[model samples]
Target: MDSHGSSNGLREEEIDAVAMAVIAVVVNTMADKESSSCNMLMRLRQRRALLQSVAEAPDCAATCEAVVQLCVALTSGVFPRLTPRWWIKRRTGGTWEDLRLRDDATDEYFRQKLRMSTTMFNHIVAACAAYMEKKVTHYRMPLPVEQLIAFALYRWVSGETYESGTSAFGIGRATGLQAFRDVISALLQAYPDAIKWPMGRRRAQILRAFREKGFPNCFGAIDCTHIYIDKPAGAPSENYYDRKQKFFVQAQVVVDLDLRILDVHVGYPGSVHGVRVLHNSQLFRRAESGELFDATPENLPHYVVTRGYLLGDNGYPVACPWIVSPYGGIDQGADEERFDTRQKVARGCVERAFGRLKCMWRLFLRTHKTNLETLPQQFVVVCTLHNILLDTGMDFDENLL
Candidate 1:
């Protein structure tokens, strides 16, 4: 009857009949002869259209019963919004000073929430502040770099979702996520300056620490651990599911005696073996080419065959000469048994490193529901921060060297 229904190919006679029927009903309902029935019907339709347009206007302030009905129709799950109503809440994590002075076991509580001492946290904030700084004038929220770093650290250590962290940190979910990503990216950019294997005097210090533990010639302990991740969508997911029946990414690490991460090779899929992970690592490639561990042999104990080597478990090949694994169990002698025992003890450093790493950075302890592309960068940031914590005297007593 109206233009809205005319496009459906109604016969002219049918349209006229429908229009006349609508006009007759309207004429009977009202006593106003001031307008014709057809004109009145058209005016009624126009008013309905106006009500709908008002209801949908994003900036309109005035509303009526019609507007409320229109809202119910729009949000009845028939049409979805980019950001749901529940997501737009006030952002809330308090300031770092507020956390530091929180009256509830302040020192230990801050450490529990961030997995680092206040002093160390300050140092880290300082290290990356230049990269994460954002100006906050009267026009926008005062998003300080320190608060951004704190929010990111809180999320990483507590493994809280964006929604939960925003409520505590006093920010929106979108801001929380963006700050978390920004802080992680800044931390990764600081990696080359912060987390590096020892060389020269530092290498000597690490070697000495290993020698004290009765494993001479050991520069670091190498191993791989699976960091849980969500299965990627589509065909590429098969590459991420491992023998453990979980989706994960392999993290190859080389740690010093003090549980400090010296080198890390992250981003390999779980299906890749530890050995293959090492083979693809820069550390392994350097070792094979004799570019690493090239320090001149110095006077040492007879049991110490070389100046630099990495202690690995049976998962790696001992043929590399730089990386040593236990001998085969079959037909082994007391000497081989003793070597295996000592090697296991020496290799505990890497295992302990993994333990503390997972404990301090809770992000790695559970399955990460994040985009697969972002998981690798997150892993690298955690590793880098772990090393940075070690630099600031953070202790892990699991395997004290």
Candidate 2:
């Protein structure tokens, strides 16, 4: 084949190239017209055919490449623009001015939106600002710390899209997203200090609270909930799909009597059973390896014949020394029945904690639209904020239900 034009009036390759270009234009035009149609299955089939043709196109490599690119653009979505409006592109130019003008509201309005009292929110803003300033280099330098805090909290609590969050925060969609991520990253950096197992007086307080509830040995209640996300395109979707037929990741949490989260383990696929999740958790690992609660048999709870324990639902294993599940079957003694009842009452904390957690940070209940890898970290940030809310004497708002 010649790289330059042929001396003849028209070359064979030129004719083929013109034909392919016409095909590309026609296909793209059809795609744009059908993009918003309700018939998605039909659209998918057409796109699949187009992709196959592109792959099988003959020796005209340049034409094949152009057709392939056009097909991808057409099949992806409606209104495919040549210029992408990603957040980085709007770094210096944002809608923050728009947000400031509309944000004149009462403290209660702020509380409802952020799911925290004014005092609690202010405290966190101060803590996160101070902590993140020392750690992150020139973090979102143009945006005010309060606006950044509001933007992050609004996204987390409302489960809004990044585009909507940007509009609300008066910034570029990408900037709003980056700000939320930076805040969460900074929070994770401080996770060790902010979210920790109770120690000394705190431990004594937790134990005392459990004892008062008629479960003398219970330190925390354990349970798991799924955080839904979009299934990836190339990966095995079945692995991420749950028994409920939804795509999600599992989050296992242990909550103390006051509804404070003591430990959290997230990032497992939803297909995994709750017990299996617990088995894979660091808490379980440490307990099995004899490092978590290194106390003598004499120091263990009297109710447990082997070791100390946390109250858990029937989804957990009864044989695990560190976890106590209620008795099963119809024929049970009165003592067994009574013990089961009390355990149920005590273990209710975990369920309530999850309920409040989801209610306050509605993001957990929504299908998180971010990258799959980033979803778990966002869940951890929500759990971290939940702990912060409980620690600051902030009560779960009943109205959110």
Candidate 3:
């Protein structure tokens, strides 16, 4: 048990010394092949200098290893031919750079896949940067934004946390907490076209989905979801003011039978009731406007083929004549009960959409700390693409589907 050497057995500290010794011997032996004992000692010093040039930046050692290791694991599934160059793909997708990602799995097709796999990842980060540049900086920060937003749907929809999402990025825990929110905002604003509410198209898409599902005139399933924010400064009982029993903002969304989000209504105080949320929603106002339905679109019954109303929760006012539901004050078996059950069943589409939405983005899991000032923007960012991801072509078969 020598302090720096293996005697009885190598202790933890001795193990490092042994590893270094082995490395030293390997280098020396290679040099010794061309000459006798110490002829190439000078060359050995050059090798150490090369190693220093590749040293990890201060405090970034583990993070770099983690990123490289994660890349290795992901690419390995798609790339089996395992050479360093073959295992690496450009995060930018344009030109190949020397990432030095070596692998041992010697399959030719798999190795080709390794190079191919990085192309999509490069696009992911590029998309994030393009969005962020417009939304946050308006094309100011020239640095490449990580693929945080693109992979988000994969995480929440597929079930993962912020920590897991940024495992590929060099971002840390607290940074991730803020970064996720920041990225969503930039994404929504920058790529509104990518996640826009189809002013007229919603009508057609909803009609089609309703017909397929055997429900008519159904535009969408609507619901109120609350996102918690920290209680404001000097607000009395703010902490106790939420439906979920927390200080928060309540927002509503209208998603169609296909779980495609058609409209979003966010940015209300938690003190706002669900009915109030709908009443204030642009979707409800538009529905009540009757300009289109009366003219071109022709007021498709609120919930078309079901020959009733679009679906919603109990907190919504029983505009029972226009919208079908159990009379809030009436018994469960009242004339509206059967209708209410059917509406609830239809409403499940949006609920499941919300679940899948939340499942796809871990940022929704926690109550983000924000004031009323920014509440609407955050909720909008979360909802706008809540429906578009259905088309993002993300695979869920790896899960039970």
Candidate 4:
């Protein structure tokens, strides 16, 4: 009799008898079907790599095994036969229910197996664990934290609803909502300086990085993305509209060459025009004070800003300091066209940065679940994490954007 049996309410003698009987049954069964049992065990071992975990400790490791079992139960019906796109369940395409795990069968099997692997969990664990501590409090248990956070970011990027996050991320309704907020909060707090400076030595390095090309000192790519927010239930907010007229929170962001957000203005009450927001922003003031300085090439241009430019889209007012879109019919020459192409290419950095930030960390993108009043602080947090990812050189999925 073992203490474990007693914990299960079985008396010691009774447990001992049942254990011996079970052992005898296993021995007899294994002897009668040795090859079959061995093959079954081998199959189980092969699939063990696909599980998720909280930590590497034995208990946490076991929880990962449990996840594998759950996945198997849910996915086994379609594993070998189903196509990857098909297995997604809610998809309406013909690919539905025929999901192929990979290009080849064995590779697909191994791919599925990795879901249970300690190595795989290690990566998810990296994002879920202490990596975010610089911005969040410490709390580790309940492995669902990994999936919840992963799905929250995915939902934001996909522009799906919060309910989609819950179902896709395997989080309960309440947990799904709370986790979206918690992960975003932790990220913003951990990397308070996620939005880095395009200044000093850093600015010099960026200039040098692009100096070989014809482009001169470029501070950052400036752009405004219309973040659609839930409108105030009560307000006289007709001004938020453009000539086309739409309700959205106009957020202006400036990201350095590395795609790290340098500055953001998000509290414009969902009605302010992009031009108005920038006019009052600190970025405009700093540029006006003749503050942007050159680090080398001792020409010492009268306005250091005269040498540098903020790459902007068609919506912005462009100048020597602000490289706005090409002037109407300004086909000065092929070289000018080449420069225009480069500027447009460079302008994408900000839009792509916003796309990635919203995709990876959902605190932005203005979901209906978010409180209207909390938008400002949430905007700050999302921008901050966007920079942290840049600093870390974390591999973000470009194809997603």
What's the TM-score of every candidate structure? 0.71, 0.70, 0.54, 0.54
lDDT of 1 by residue, 110-221 (tens): 6778877777777778888878877633223346787788888888887777767777777777787788788888887755666686878888888788878776667888
Candidate 4 residue-wise lDDT, 14-48, digit = tens = 43454454335334333422234665576444434
> What digit string (tens of lDDT, one per residue) describes model 3 on residues 159-257?
345555445443345655666566666767555764444446656666666656545655666777766555665555553286557777666777777
Show model 3 residue runs off by greater than 4 Å.
Answer: 1-124, 131-143, 147-182, 194-202, 211-214, 229-240, 291-309, 320-322, 327-337, 366-375, 397-401
lDDT of the candidates, in the order given: 0.71, 0.71, 0.51, 0.55
TM-score of 3: 0.54
State the TM-score for model 4: 0.54
Q: Give lDDT for model 4.
A: 0.55
After superposition, candidate 4 runs with Cα above 4 Å error: 1-151, 167-178, 199-201, 230-239, 269-271, 290-307, 318-326, 329-342, 354-370, 376-385, 391-398
Q: By summed lDDT, which 10 consecutive residues of candidate 1 come out lowest?
A: 76-85
Task: Name the runs in model 2 displaced over 4 angstroms.
Answer: 1-105, 130-141, 294-307
TM-score of 2: 0.70
